[model samples]
Target chain A: MKNFDVYVKKQLLEKYPSMVFFLVVMLFPHFGAKAFGLFFIMLFSLASDVRQKRLDLMTFLPLNRRQIFWMEYLFLCLLLSTTFFVGLPFAERSIYAWLVLVRSFIFFSSYFGVIISAVSIGFDPYGAAFLFLLVDLVLGGIGSSQLGPTFNPYKLISPVYQANLLASLVFALILIYMAYRLFTQRGGER
Target chain B: MIRVEHLRKQLGNKQVLSDVSFTVEPGTIFALIGPNGAGKTTTIRCLTGALQADGGQIELFGENYKNFSQIYLKERMAVVPEERHVFRNFTAKDYVQIWSRLYSKWDDTIFSNFVARYSFDLSQKVESYSIGMKTILFVGLCVASQADLLILDEPTQHLDPTVRLEIMDMLKECASSGRTILISSHEIFEIEEYATHFGIIKEGRVIYSDSIDNAKENHRIVDKGENLQASDVIGLVGSSVLVKTKSDVGRYPRLNEIVVGYLTGHHERSLSLR
Candidate 1:
């Protein structure tokens, strides 16, 4: 636990600039633009570490792979969620607006989880970004009757209540859990 | 204490570590000497858990590594990876603070003395330090961690000759204080002067491993073309042949002789077979 704390603190200190930038970006009025900005901000923050091989420094410390992965995820969630929550009252008053904000956060987190996991397993972050774009397009469900809204990333942000926020939250948690497993299993190679 | 048996690793299409095996007794400096791409770094990576092995066993302190807790293993070991990387944005003081928080046995006095001896500017960012300074800084950190086991990969790569000798002496002192050291290096002459034991790796395989004294005692350098069994011969040393013999007929081989003989002999034999 001490090691975990130190790791979290180090990460926070190292990426505080990015964190501030993320907070500023979250203040953008449009939900779609905010969600889009959040995705890239989170990806670039984490991907910089992966691409620079900074994770190697943490691996040598007392912390295990699981601790490192979750610590990174924890900071990402805490920082981004805090920014979203703090800015909520000033931006939106209605329960429906709140639901839209929560849904967008959840969907983007789910996508971020997948991309981060791929990056953890040595995939190029730019390549994973391309992968995410493909998933977003498919989830847009453009003229596809077979592909439904159950897992559609577009529904959560569309503001039409096509997808349930609770269901999206659950799906996001599941994807995050899978990402945790994948990182712990294969993340130590470098 | 460390023991590795039949360890294997395949990176991409290359079998980086085909069958590496070695052991280091407590409080001994065991040098892992090998040529470039000979899998020395790969073996070190596997042992440090940075890379997983494809096959075989590794035992640290008599406990199987698979069953051992990595946190526990890390708590007792300090490693200086080959790259000698640092947090580019952090100052020396920041780096020390992080190390102190993470390592339970971190010795501030030791680190302070090192900083003082080297006159390192604590306020300057690590990225601004010269290559040699970065190497020195990590070496200092490894020593100050005060872990029971120290694994350094090319620890003295970027240092001046005088500092290299000083670092080697410091490592010698670390071993004298009952810490086991496993160093993977290409500095044959430097390591020969300080290492108590050695493992020579060639082509992803451990060709020979033994204590310096025992290796010298058991092997001899004879004139080339001496009548010896194929298995008894280790390698060639210029005009002489190195063979495992006990008849008191040939001069004992130096550490470099043994290493060069095995690496070059193996290379020649492989070429002849083709």
Candidate 2:
């Protein structure tokens, strides 16, 4: 009945074990591990959908391509928000901790956006992940310098001043919007 | 109730559906027939909005499927897709309950009747079901939802002849009760039995569509010996002439003969729509 609700529930069940594993792993201060876990979950979800040819089953449903993309985006946002809440107290309410949270939110949103866009645009989950990894590595290499802090996608925790952090936040938001545009074009490829 | 015009779709390097066009009148059973890889399934996909068309229009219930919201379209239809597999996460009963709540016209009594007919246990997990049982459960759910339009792809594909016959009766009842049925089936004999209209598709195009009577009336089966030198020979299979120029034809042709005439021998020619 509630198609979106059912879809979210189904995805949650499919990835429950991995999610729990990531949640526990994030309890430690290692943001890189948690980020990798989150990315893995994203890739796994897309891979399963692609492998099973989910569209063949979904075509009979009333969902259009944009709706399908929105469902995926909703799922990603929910999972990310829930995990972030669970980790909120660990920072001990310091401004330093708030900065980490802000930066992580921006960084994760951008990564999620790109990954979903890649999968929606006909890349297999594996291919998308590897391509994203390659691009991030190249960008990090270019940005590495004392003059400008490197834009290392793998880094989750580090000191960031307000001005640059805000700029990064704006850039990440733009990427999220662009991913929406690309993901909306998905469907009918099946 | 259905009108399709110049629907086109390209997948990967191949154009899967091209310039396909047809219509299904209200309460009419339109059987979309074709050989494997002849685009019957693709046509069904485009019609159901599972796959979008690159070009063309699809109108149903006086609204274009391409431009209308999916919720508006779904409110009037129930579909049984080609995939017969049921999700292992839910029991058949769970799905029935979910759909019953989803559709405004769902009939619980009808749902119960179909479950009884199929002898399905709602308590059983879907993974425990055989392929045929899964299909029966899905079909039952679709039928009991009480939508006005039913779009089914290969609905009777995996069933035994007895069950297939039962389904034929069920669909006939649905049609006679005023539902518009669009079905794509390879069971030529089954289509011949119940379909009031027919459309034969090949390589992404609808080659022919007409009433069953009209299709039969327009084509003839000639003995190959008599039509060997005839320039109008449509096709020859073994010792039989599957099709030839219209005349006082030598013999009555079955629907299968007419279909084979298009698929086997007409591969190199442009679409010849009747």
Candidate 3:
């Protein structure tokens, strides 16, 4: 398992430098906080594995399928956590920045889980990416509209963004669990 | 010894392997032969434990493979898959080093010797090596591991005739050293020359498997009399005898006579011909 981890990390490090450069250019300075690009970067990197068929190699290894899945999740989480720490000084030294960072990581991880599950079921990476973007945009629009004039802190519709973030985290967890189940089931037959 | 019993697998609606079973003893090279889409690779995948068998069991070295840990089983085995997928950026030496760490029995001296003998450029990235060179490196890794069981699928798929023969000789040498080898290939003639045992799979089943000499003796293409149809024969000693051709009242009576004469040696010559 440790060797496998080292192999994955080695592969990532070999490609991450160039990817970070591309991400930096695409989502330049002061774009809804630098951390916004981190989510996209994580998603793209995970999706890149799907596109290249590197994910298939995991199934061939001796480790449990679920264990492999969680390792991938942890690796992504570590990347997100590192990005958050690096961006902490850049964002104003306020609790909001920290909260946003945590919330974003949770939301991004959950979304990634759902997307990876979809990919496992024969979803094309580009199509899945496009669909994810469209769905997020629609949900974000709906939530922003609900948080319109005269926002009440105690109302069901109030604190709309936070509620959406919480919902995203819940859905992400569910999707990841489902993805884990699906991969394990398919792996058993392999 | 390696024993596979009732191994079965399905992918989507297609049944890849059904009730596949075979046993390979130590110091012997077994060739698994089949046409394309005949489930050769799928069966190999299951035996290597890369893919799970939907049903059945695989015992390697007198123990259930599933009961053993991955590292434990993998330490004693190595595979050279049909498609050689080496890490593109890593040089041949780096690939060897990485695999060496994975297999406890890996021999660095043997690896270095093979590298030198094969004239592989350790400095060049694996991606830069030609297909044949990549195959050489893949085989080198298997050899260096010193694993008791070596499973290869189409190991010579992309090599020139000379290199392919060299690889086959290497496998023979490995087997002679008391290791077991199970290889699947479409190259029948090459397999016929080196393999001690033969397992011919067709459409996900082991239609025929036995020692090479026994298989030859068992699957004879007997040409009978023009009026005596080949399909009409019953209680034949072998599995199946494919009839290549049959003609009536032709110049081939001597051929039929020759086959009948051979069969008489095994059976009662007094039996009346129809």
> Top DockQ: which candidate number?
1
Best by lDDT: 1
lDDT of 1 by residue, B168-249 (tens): 9999999999999999999887888889999999888887899999988888888855566443776778888888778675
Instruction: Please identify model 3 stretches exceeding 4 Å from their true place.
Output: A22-47, A50-64, A143-168, A187-190, B49-52, B60-71, B224-274
- Candidate 3 lDDT over B1-51, as tens digits, reads 889888889876788988688999999999888778878889877766556
The CA lDDT at B52 in model 2 is 69
* Cα deviation of A106, candidate 1, in Å: 2.0
**Residues B173-237 of candidate 2: C-alpha lDDT, one tens digit per residue:** 99999998989988887788888898988888887788887877767777745643343556765
Judged by whole-model lDDT over C-alpha atoms, candidate 1 comes out at 0.77
> Which one is best on TM-score?
1
TM-score of chain A, cand. 3: 0.72
For A1-190, candidate 3 gives per-residue lDDT tens digits of 6666555654574456645763453232232443355445655564556556554443333344555666667766666566566656666667776676656665555556656766666666457755765665555445233457744322221121435555556666776788776655553242
Question: Any residue pairs clashing in model 3, and if so which?
Answer: A110-A172, A190-B51, A190-B52
Q: Write the per-residue lDDT of candidate 1 for residues A1-190, one digit (tens) a residue.
A: 6776776667666776666666687765446656766676667665667667766677666666667767767666675566667677677577766765676667566766777678777787767776666755566554332356545455553222325566667777877787777766666255
Ordered by lDDT, highest first, the candidates read 1, 2, 3
Whichever of 1 and 3 has more lDDT, that candidate is 1
Per-prediction DockQ comes to 0.51, 0.40, 0.21
lDDT of 2 by residue, A1-190 (tens): 2777766765665557656776666544335645665666766664457445665555466565566666776776677666666777775666765555565566566666667666666766577667766766554445433444655442321112223566567766776787777655554166
Sorting all predicted structures by TM-score, with the top scorer first, yields 1, 2, 3
